[model samples]
Target: MLSGLLMIVDMQNDFVTKNGSLYFPQAEKVKPVVIDIVKDRMKREYDLIFTKDWHDPNDLEFKRFPVHCIKETYGAEIFDDLKFIIRDYSKINFVMKKRFSAFYGTNFDDILKNLSPKHVEICGVDTNICVMYTVEELKNRDYDVVIYENGVASYDEKLHEFAISQMRDVLGAKIEKWRSFNAQH
Candidate 1:
């Protein structure tokens, strides 16, 4: 049986690039960590997944957040640095999410049912929002979740730290440094 699943969440151009509508500077630093996690997961032969924030032009989420990552646009595409890597990897489950939680309006549950991974490891953007919400849902579903601390960041430093703590304490997800996973495998 496969021991783990690696989920790269919301690592889209809109969240990672400087000129994006909702650009956060910390996202640049987190990109390399996310890339490293992807490479490690590739070597480990675990089920790999990516969650994209594929919003519509009139998405209701635009009321609270800035309009970004519209479907079929460059902003909705994966960050350039990671795109080629994912492209080269043949087995990737791409989940297009309309909401903060990937499982809310997508085929994520079906994919999980098929893979049946022993644990899920997550890494991606907006530690306080999409990442946090997805982690919560995974925990609710009783999946053993491990979040890569160095691979997650948000626009607000306070909220990022708060979300990390909340996931660790309240959600019961394991929070570990990304380097440790590489060292182990």
Candidate 2:
């Protein structure tokens, strides 16, 4: 039985790979770490959930940021490196979000409620933005949350550190390095 869920937020090509419209170089650097976490989890019984920024071409969010992850585009797809590992398509939940917070404008909360995972391990790109919002929502909903520090990254180094500290201190999340987090599980 699955006791927990591994929530991979915004690990799409646009955020984690080179030549993407909104690429974060730091995100690319953590790909190996994220991959290791996912691979290790795949060998276990936990559920894996992947969230993608499935924005519209004319999305209002484009006003503030560059066009990215337009639905059905290469940028909207998961990074090629991790694509094949998503073998259990039926068990994997793919949440599509138009906004930064996965809970907003989506059925993420409903899905979480149904899964009823005891713990939710969150890891992905833009630690200060999308990942931060998701962590806030998860905590507000009273879910046990753990963040893989090494598996998440942000373009801004300072913001990333601040977000991690906030998630730990303010949101009551347990932050652990991927290696240590995986070893115990």
Q: Identify the leading candidate in terms of TM-score.
A: 1
Q: Candidate 1 on 78-175: residue-level lDDT in tens?
A: 99989988787876999999999999979999999999999999999999999999999999999999998998999999999999999999999999
Tens digit of lDDT per residue, candidate 2, span 1-185? 33888999899998888899989778867888888888777777678889999998999999999999999999999999888777554568899999999999899988887888999998998899999999999999888899999999999999999999999999999999878435766
For candidate 1, the per-residue lDDT at 184 reads 65
Off by over 4 Å in 1: 180-185
In model 1, what are the clashing residue pairs, if there are any?
A: none
lDDT of 1: 0.91
> TM-score of the candidate numbered 2?
0.94
Would you estimate the TM-scores of all the predictions? 0.96, 0.94
Error of 1 at 124 (Å): 0.3
Residue 31 CA displacement from its true place in model 2, Å: 0.6
